[model samples]
Target: MITRLAGPAMHRPKLILVLVGIAFLICGAIGSMATGRLTNGGFVAADSESARVAEILERDYGMSGMQLVFTVESDGGAQAPASAARGREIAERLRGDERIDKIVSPWTDPAMGSMLTSGDGKIGLIIATVLGGENDAPAHAAELADELTGARDGVTVHAGGQAMVWSETGTQTQKDLALAEAIALPLTFLLLMWFLRSAVAAAIPFITGVAAIAGTSAVLYLLTFAVDLSVFALNITTAIGLALAIDYSLLIIGRYREEIANGRDKRRALELAMQRGGRAVAFSGLTVGIALVGMSFFPMDFLRSLAYAGLAVVLMSIVLTLTLVPALLTLLGDRINRKPLREAKPVEQSLLYRIARVVQRRPAVCALPVLLLLVLLGSPIVGVKLGLPDERVLPTSLESRQVGDLLRDRFSGNGLGTVQIIVAAPARDGAVPDLRDYQAALSEVADVRSVTGPAGIFSGGELRAPAGPGTTAADSAYVAVATGLDPYSEAGQRQLDALHAVPEPGATVLFGGFAQQTADSAANIAQGFPYAVVWIAVVTFLLLFLLTGSVVLPLKALVLNVLSLSATFGALVWIFQDGHLGGLGTAATGYTIATIPVLLFCVAFGLSMDYEVFLLARFTEEWEQSDKTRQANDDAVALGIARSGRIVTAAALLMAVIFLGISASGVTMNRMLGLGLALAVLMDATLVRMILVPAFMRLLGTANWWAPARSRGFLEKVALRE
Candidate 1:
């Protein structure tokens, strides 16, 4: 199979490469077109608690629950020349702009009045939220910034709210993803070359990984039209794609080379590589892909994107494993083992022998240190802070970020996107009262800073703030309210629930905002994520167990896998979120990505397992012929490490470096995730795989073969048994 394809490709390599290139371009063009229409929008009523409560009672309830906040503040206490007057002018101009469908602020123009409030009571803020699918933000922002900034005016006028946040954050997120996308394969290539020590061999794995990314990226691009593609999706796809591609290509390439060295004909070698190595690659990718898809249960759009991205990358990896890799191997023929492939290095008296000697000698001495280290590192997780990602992620020089800092200390800043408590008209049994009790109750909440409509009617009913003629105490009859709190903090979440707890007979209560959203986001993750981990483990176990015919070996693989992931998680805490050693490269402002843990766990698991499969599969094979299971195991582990460990470690190190490269980015979320995942892979390659795996395996003894009797018997019957 490989010889036929390679013969024809080698005859005309340029033609085949060009055809592939053309297809890639066409796919990209189509994907780009599709993504163009798909804009990343802010999750509104989503971030608010009041909106959620209201969503239950009516149609379009979710749409009505979000509050739009727009504000412009003065630079410190310095009085600027005529800026306040310009801000007032901008407001007047917006009152008549056709692009603006609505304005909610304290402006007294009865015609344009919707609650437009003046900042400093001098610098006025305009609030606009899309209720009927209207976005007055772009036009409003353009006019305001142009009028304010264009005049060389020191006073800066900015428009922000759900829409603005979405527009800005989404664009930045794409750039970060693009950086990752561009770098994943090149990094994969360098590692493969350095490890394999053969340009052809190195090129093979990287080519496969790149194809997987490209093909899967096309597929994920298509899925975007149907679902919201989370910015986090690209990270997952690239991570999984690179790992699986490397694994898939590695297996086939190794098998092809092995067949050749065993004196098989070119065609015969290709056939064996396809028949045997291909099977393992298929199952491995499938298991990992299925695990990734499990994230969809979380209900967050971000997690959902990972589901499809994982699935796509897995499929792409498989395609390359099954097709492209065979073509490459057929083309390379005997050249793959450029180092003059040595006969299987004797593993009998190697590291495995030493470990076996440890297990056979003094198990307690070997295992104690290993177990103690895992527990010690896992301890800091007790202090884990699951804070939502913040806009402090933006460079301090950015207007929104600088102002957000001001807001956090002096006012609410971006953290103000919390606590939506609904105040509404009083209701009688089975009937809403003519009076707006919701508006009145809103004023009663101690956490509130401002209030907006229960003024308009939903399918549920109208809400109203407390009654008053002017800006003083008597203001009434609004939807629910707006409040200030540390968004997503313990106090903030409690305040949100308190607003929801208002049990008034006269009016309906609702809570919605950053706190409510964050709480829901956290809950959804907790319930949905265990499945992802389980699915990965179960599938990986089945595949590895079958390939090796050693239930014990899979357990060993799993242990190493877990350790790799845990070590990285701890490092992530120390570097990205804790601000300890944050000045070092795995560094960023002390904020983690909102969905990073999920991505980090999945990506790290896939990567660690990538090395696990490459090294252990060989051992499982050798152990088949050696009746002495311990000797075969020792030799395989030792030889596998000696032969491929350098390459895998190098690849991991390079990948980690690529991740650290992103630390230089202005976006804090990107830096956090980049640094977190980088440190994880680096630690995995050096400590977890090197020190811990061998030490523990040295201690497990034959009971590491703790399979149930029936399964053990089955494994023994199959040649896969070690």
Candidate 2:
């Protein structure tokens, strides 16, 4: 059934495409090195208890600043005070560092007006108030941490607070990102090797994926000039880029192999693949781009930059895979298939195939059963929790975690954390708030412990603190508060609401706390939801129209894609939020993070549509050749189902394996992604791809490809442009 063009139209010019890709690669390399550390516009890592404490001090506490908390430990098991004296020496050293605005260790806390040390004296702390901006933070903090490592033989530095959290998270995040690429690329190579049965073809996609990530990183580095970037951006950028590289290259190579098997010569097979598979790939890339770009609705600068970063890689992935992979195929040709694996091929029909056939036969029976199952998984969304991030990251069995538990139990949620209500411009001469009035109002509220203000600033209709030589009106006031709610508790969320509600007459009020972080994240999602819908719609139509050359076809796919994605998201809400999955315990990332709905959709839509494209591309090809609607439809189901179905199932299983591996890493973010991705992959591979898709197509009949001739011609032109 492979048709060869009789004239010059069959062959493509390969040398030019190769040169273009090389040029892009060279340019991309120079860029990554320059921009690797920029935060890329993520909301500064301020949604934490430390941030909340900072906010409370600036707005409510009548102070100019605050201090951090660190836990410096030693597993060296020293019995004498001399060994413990070494830990004290490290604290003393840190107390004298120049970058340290001030320090509060056992020797210094009395002046800072704080606790000197823990009761046993084994664990000592140094509280430092940094003087410079976030830019100067990592290097300074790292230097400080490195300096402190000397006093004890086996010191385990567990640092938290804004400074240490950002620095350490950045380092660990790089490791995670590397781990993802390290795992994905090798696995892709193994899968490709098994599929193409040749080391060359297998290596080509892996190489292309690496190139795309490398190149995208370069471009992203430059993007940091115009925007902020996250410390975690580098790892995520590489991971996403690598994933997409394999995806697009796999499509092209698969088509090239299919063309060759259908009796076309190597050169002709490359052309057909570059044309057909390239067309599908370009559309798929757009779909992924839309998913990535759609995050712009979120107000968090981190998300905005993250969206751009992901889109950049998807575009680069498409470009490199379509051009470089094809050019490489031109050179490698038949050698790409040189070493086919020698294994017993499974029978054509499988349990998945049988289920698909049943759906094809009865349609509704196939759709209803799986649809219900997804609904059940998503029942956890009702009691969703959201909030500031903290590094209570260790297990309950760990000493630090255990001590924290004891403190919470003894003090009824005693915390270094604080929540603030910032009444903006309150210290201006005419507009200065009455400290007596403000304090009285706040005191009336449940948690108000103390209120401090600027020089001459008043609350409770009077000045709460004596006017001092050290104070200024421009400086914000600080308030201290007692709390019945745990800093991490759902009940604490109400504190955020009250803070935001504080009277700001002729001024502004900001709630800065862990509760506030969660509140803002939730609020951002609530407000941005409509935009997300519009974004998804625009993205879905554009990708679908490009793929099938029919307005109707893309719309139909959109309907199902939405259905499938929502089903998956809904399930996550249920299992994680409702705690319906009893064994998972309190460990889930509380209702999948405020941003996860969008993240999940971006990932799930592209993946779900993956099988759709594979199936529809084959089906459409058969229909066009035969012009007998029923015959072509049957051939597509039989052949398309026969060919792509196996690959889809295989890819899903592999993807599941990778996700499951990360799930074992014990990071909350990774675990959520693992569950969501694993669910999406499995469902798309079987229920959506095997059952719902075929059922819908069977119901659509000839109308599935109903584009006016002019439109089809337009699509053909579009394909050429692609």
Candidate 3:
């Protein structure tokens, strides 16, 4: 198959390369525009109960929640007439803005005025409801912030809220994407040059990386028309695209160099290299692509968008590896080796080879300790706490984060955030038992600060005031439950759980707000996780079995990959969640983002499989060549590591470097992702691939090639071998 394609390509390499360049230029330009089309916010499923309640509240009650906040600190005191004047001025100014739906401040509603004032009586808030969707909030907020903040007649004003958070998140993500590329690209080019030892050869991978990224970006742009693409997908496009392109190119070009040095003519060498290297790249791309497809099983657009971006990257890398890289190799010919430096002396008993031999000699001795160590590393996840993404996910220095901190620490009522409990009842019920029981039950729950419903304001199981004037739905009413804890914290989750467990008579209760949204997000992920796992497991097993023609090897590979990820998870929990590495410029959030584990699993598992296929392909080749003996098994293990270990190590290091650059992002989730996946790839390549693989294979011996005799025909039909 490869020979047929390459034979024609060699005849017109220049034309093919030129067209490839043109396509890249066009696709890249289109893809660059994708950033503008991308929207943020997929932390919770839109169809969830929390989402439904929020929708009802907004559409029916005209309460779209606090989209932006203006903070005023009085040079005097918050209760002073002068301070009230400034707060009122800011509120009136916001009301005058056509974009704002409503502006609520201590100066506007005397009943809730004190609640909006700080404890020290120096700060007051004006919470504004902006017109637009979450994606539009940032632009509106930016404009409002510029006008509302700085100096407002003798008072200082600062603006913040979810709208500002999303807008700033989008902005920071774009900057960080550029920063990661800036850090990774030059280093990657140097690494490629050092490894290939030819500037012309090194340029091949860069070209491939750029084309893959641009093509992926262009695909993402097209996807924006069909589905809501997350701005986060841009980061995925650059990181995964560049890393995989370079990896596939390294494998292909390395093989081409070896075949040429072995005295094959250019065309024959190219055909042979394509047949072997191209096949491996195809399988690797399939494995990575399958993992991404598994992530798409989740209902959240966040994970789904990643799948879209990831699949584009994988497909682009495969196409370029098969077509563009091969064309470049044909065009360059021995120029790939122009002014070639002398090769390093071959070490028959290198460290990797020696380690493999040692493992093969005493399989249990090597495998058990490593397995134990990985499990130990992953142990901290036992204490994992999941939460919704909040302002804390932003950099600590961000204005939004600072405002959130002040609100949490200094204010009351909505400052702590509210959980809206929707109580549905027919108007014929006349707001009797349904509203009364829900309010009373919720008020009786532990940590319940207050509950305001159609019946009244209930606190500590007693009525504080009669129900305030507001439009009552013909069929439903919303009771706002206030808590003293941040709604994305453990205390808030516990409070929310208690609220849900409360018995409501004659009403259908639906909870909404930050706490409820966090719960709903967790529930959705839990429900979707099994489907993703099943998809990944079944597809990976089938793919690996087809490649190796051995059920035992594929299952073994799966187990080892899982083990490697355990260590990665362990490190993430210990360092990021537990703050063990807080001294290293790490921003430790006591709880992990709920979606991060899922993202890490998809990315890390795919990368693990990449290295797995790379190593096992070489092992299968060696096994096929050797005579079927115990001694031959030993030789295959030794020789496979010798031939492939360098590529695996170098690729792992380079990919890790790229991911480390991603870790440098200001976004906490991206930082966690970068660190976790980098750790997993390094562990998989060194500890699992090098050590555990040889140990397990040695222990299994000839059994590594075993499959049921009934499967022989199927294996012969599908098995990939040299």
Candidate 4:
């Protein structure tokens, strides 16, 4: 297949380049509009209780919760005549806006005055419900935030809430994406030039990188019409696309250069390089792509969007690597090696070969310390706490975060953390008693400050105010329960659990709020996690077995990949969750983002398998060529590590460069992703790939190539080899 593709490229390199260039240009044009089409919210599971409640609230009750919060600060005091007047003016301004569905302020409704005012009486809260769906709400909130946030008429206002936070997060992500690209691209090129030792050869990877990103973006843009995708998917697509492009390019070019130096003509060299290196690239992409597909087992669109983005990027990288890269090498010919930065060393004399030899001699002695180190590094994962993203995910410099901090610290109650409960009770007079009892019971639960419902505002199992208009409908009623806990914290999750445990006889209850959403999302992920793991494992094992015709090799690769990934997760927990690394400019949030671990597992697993495929391919090739003896197996292991060592190391370093640049992002999630993947790549390349693999292979001997007869026969018929 590779030969057939390279045949035309070798004969007509210009035609291939022209056609690929035109396609990339078209893709770039279509992809330029993708960001606007992407959404900022997908963290909730669609089939979860919170989602059902949200849908009911929107469809049956016309309630979307508080989409925006305004913290109004007055110099005099909250009840001062001037301050009160300003607060009323702000309320009236919001009431007049067509986009606002409802408004609640201390100045407008004195019945709930104390709950909306700060403890010191110097700050007041105004909550507004925006009239729109999830995508439209953020946009509306951004406009409102811009219009109302700032000092005006002797009072200062700061805007925040779900919609505002979503808006700010999207804006910040765009800026961070630009910053990441600025940091990663130039550094990657310099490293590429150093590794490839030719400006022309380095350019090939860059070209392929740009094409992959653009093509993936275009695919995502089209996908948005069919299903909602997260804006954050763009970040992963860019980082992984560029990294894979460079990785595959290095593998192909390295082999082509080795073939050329061995006296093969340019055309024959390209053919052999594509045949050998291209097969590995294809298998590597399939492994990574399958791993990413495991995310679809989860119910959250956030993970699914990432899955789609990753799959698209992998597909683009593979297609271009097989086609455009070979064509470019065909055109460059001998010029690909011009102006060498350094001369190449023989495979047997390379540092990787020497290290493998030492480990092979004393497999147990060399393997134990590395395993212990990885285990020690991975120990911190035991304390990992997962939660959904919130204001803290944004930098403290943002206005929304500042407002959120004020609400959490200065305010008397958690208005933004209000747990909205929908009760499916008939809105007749007969149901009023049951609804009031349910509200009072909720107010008496642990962490509950108050509960306002159709019957009245209840606290400590008693009514504090009369029934309010708009809290009841024909067949449903809305209850807002306020608590002081941070909604995204572990304590807040406990509060949600307590709320769920409360009995509401004769009426069905659905909880909807930021806290409930977080709890549901975590539950959904936990429920699906085992299945996703099984899928990844089963498919990865199958792909590896097909590539190597060995069940033992696949199992070894899976176990080693897990160890490396565990260490990576532990580092992330220590640095991002426990807040040990203060130098990265991001503070520890005490909890990992719920989706981040799942995201990292799929991405890093696929990437780890990527390098695994690279090394194992060479091992299989060498073993196939040798006599069937224990000494020959050891020699094959050494020669395989020696032959593919530089390509793997260079690719890992380049991939690390991309991820490290991602670590420079101001957003904590992006930082965690960047730093975690960077750690995973470096550890896998040096410790796992260099030390553990060679040691284990030595210990396993001829058993490493063992497979059942029937399985071997099946693989022989469908193996992805030249």
Identify the leading candidate in terms of lDDT: 4
lDDT (0-100) at residue 194 of candidate 1?
67
Q: For residues 1-722, could you state the per-residue lDDT of candidate 2 as single tens digits? A: 11222112224525545565676677666754643366412442355443554545544443322233455545432223554566457666766666666555544444322233343444555566654445565457666666554434555544444555455555555556557666666776787787667798787777777687668778677777777766545655665566667766777777777777677888777778877777667666777777677777777776777788778778778767756776677667778776342232432455554655666778777678866776665554455565544433323433334444434443333335456555445445535454445545554455544344433333344455564343223534444443445656665666545644666545544556556666667677677668977887876776666656667777877777776776777776666555557514334434446666756777667666766666666666666677657546654565566666655665566555555444433334454555676677677777777777777766666677777777866787774232
Lowest summed lDDT window (length 10), candidate 4:
425-434
How far residue 508's Cα lies from its native spot in candidate 1, in Å, is 5.7
Highest TM-score scorer: 4
Q: Taking the tens digit of each residue's C-alpha lDDT, what string does model 4 give over 693-720?
A: 9999989899999999877677878987
Which 10 residues in a row give candidate 3 its minimum summed lDDT? 338-347
lDDT of each: 0.57, 0.59, 0.82, 0.86
Model 3: what TM-score? 0.96
State the lDDT of candidate 1 residue by residue for 142-161, as single tens digits. 34444544322555566555
lDDT score at residue 511, model 1, on the 0-100 scale: 53
Candidate 4 accuracy as lDDT = 0.86
Instruction: At residue 345, give the lDDT of candidate 4.
Output: 62
Residue 105 deviation, candidate 2, in Å?
A: 6.5
Instruction: Give candidate 2's TM-score.
Output: 0.80
All models, RMSD in angstroms: 6.0, 5.9, 2.2, 2.1
lDDT string for model 3 (1-722, tens) is 55565555667888878988899889978988898888877778889998999898888787774478878887687767877887887788878887788777888977777777888888988888887776676788988787767865577777778888887888889999989989988998898788777788889988888787788888889888978888888886678888899899888887777677667888888888888887788889999999888879888878887887788778878877788888898888888786532354454657888888888878898889998999899898899888778777788677787788788778755554778877777466555354665687789887777889888999888889999866367567878887777788777888887877787667577888888888888887898899998899899999889888788999998888888887798788888778886814655657888888888888889989998898778778878888878778778878888777777787888899899989989988788888888999999988898788889888888898888999999888767665
